[model samples]
Target: MLKGFLHHYYAFGLKVTSDWALPCSQRVQPTFATLEFRKQQAAFFAARVPRALRSQDPARIHYHDLEDGSRYLKWRGVFEFLISPDSQVVFGHSLDGAPAAAFRSYMLGHVFSYALLGFGIETFHATCVVVDGEAIAFLGDSARGKSTLAAAFLADGAELVTDDFLVLGREGKGYIAYPGLPRIKLYRSMSKHLLPARKGQRFTPGRVPKYLYPMEPVTKPQPLRAFYSLVSPDAIKSQTEVRIEALAPRQAYLEITENTFNVRVQTRERLESQFRWATEVVTRVPVKRLSYPRTLKVLPEVIAAVRADLQASR
Candidate 1:
């Protein structure tokens, strides 16, 4: 008999069969949905076609549509996930190491975001923090300091709402945001600079050099207060201090759509639904461009600038 590990994350109960325990999630009854792991199969998927959604990392992903109407994803050396149209059961296996090797694989990409996307859920590559009883999100490209800025806010007494994968849903007049796993991934340099005393376990020790620090996460969902696109003008040789500029609804809508996770694989119906949701979200929530000098020394000033802006808005 497979005894499932009960976990509560993103407002759902999960009975995960893998050794994937997020320190921040609450232990609950094993009555919820289950994600089982099995041995990896080499002949599980069909041939790789000449054309598919290709990222810079060629082996990052290879998606296929089988003759039997099944969808398969070969995610590099991580794992292959097979999901049915109903989006209920997900079967996964690690490409290397033991069955538990899929633990980090699922944590990195497979489990929540991909599974939710299968169900047509709208998720973004962003981190969120609760301020004044409302949620504020920071979205940006990789290594653009989304997590760095989030760490700054976490140091300054703001509670973390989510990290990396932000889940959004329609709730009455506005949208409600759910918290991801209660953790933040930070680089060694930033962790030492911002949180010198805080010890974090290494996430991708030699390869990524990032550490995962467990956070005291907010339990309930909160209405989104604002969303910001964190950018650094210093990359283009422009000297600018911390600044927050309100983005026009049109621009904000575009940014929101672009930052959506796994957008390439979305069906036409899912894309249309996301368009409607993003349109409504931008109209009500304040979307701004948060530009600041790209330097570690000014992070405190950047955090203060954001705090002042949020206060003045209220």
Candidate 2:
């Protein structure tokens, strides 16, 4: 249980109050915030969680669905999060003597996505940027250059909307993409090429180290204009050209389904709901396949192709 004073921050279109300092834009305390993060002992929260409903990743993470619609998520050697049914409050505890940075990483990444799911918000495993008053999303699997592409756009003065977790909310006839944490992760080599002057903090320090490059985040939500599903040049036989191809509605729906964030919380009802939501999104918005050579030298051309395609659509 959290006592005393709390810090308030804004991200993912929600006002969050936390007992710890979060890597988000600070905001004035609202009368009623949308989410609260509380620090608690492991045993305190564990006693409240139900038995393990299932384990999403046996070696990495375990998930438990509480009786009152809340969720309990445990990441091996990292942290445990007990989220309220309404997704309004989160109780967290570090596990296996994990560092504070590691705990914060999981909280902002997977645990945050879980709360968004509980809030009935549609999300994707993509990075987004604001271009010409509209939001463009790049959807792909890990290491498929989504962040690298977004970094390229940011270098060209495009404002970053979100990275890794793209949150969407229905607004009138269209959808709005909300801002996430104001950072993008990129490889050291890519960072040197794209943002040479900016020194970023090491996110994953290993053989292939990734740096978290900070950027000016889009403060307001932007209207979602299009989604580009990134495909590697190697994926296509004998392909070396940068091209944009429109996806049929069915294909678009499947792409969105596959790129949804946090598949562990996807129950039968949630899947059905997602199917319907994805159907609507595909019918209304354009989803295209963007294939380009995986090299830093080709990024500008890739950006130009994307801009031309967006303009052509409009």
Residue clash pairs of candidate 2: none
Across residues 1-314, which tens digit of lDDT does each residue of candidate 1 receive? Answer: 64554443333233444334445355443222444433335454333222343222556766655555445666666666666555555555566653442456354444556566656577788899987677889998777789888888778778888778787766787777765677788998898887677788776646658887777787766788789887745463576567788999899998898888665565687778888878988988888988887778888898888778889998
Total colliding residue pairs, candidate 2: 0
TM-score for candidate 2: 0.93
* Per-model TM against the reference: 0.82, 0.93
Model 2 per-residue lDDT tens digits across residues 114-206: 887786666799999999889999999897899999999989989998999888877898888888888888898999988898889877757
| Candidate 1 C-alpha error for residue 103, in Å | 4.7
Show where candidate 2 strays beyond 4 Å. 27-33, 50-58
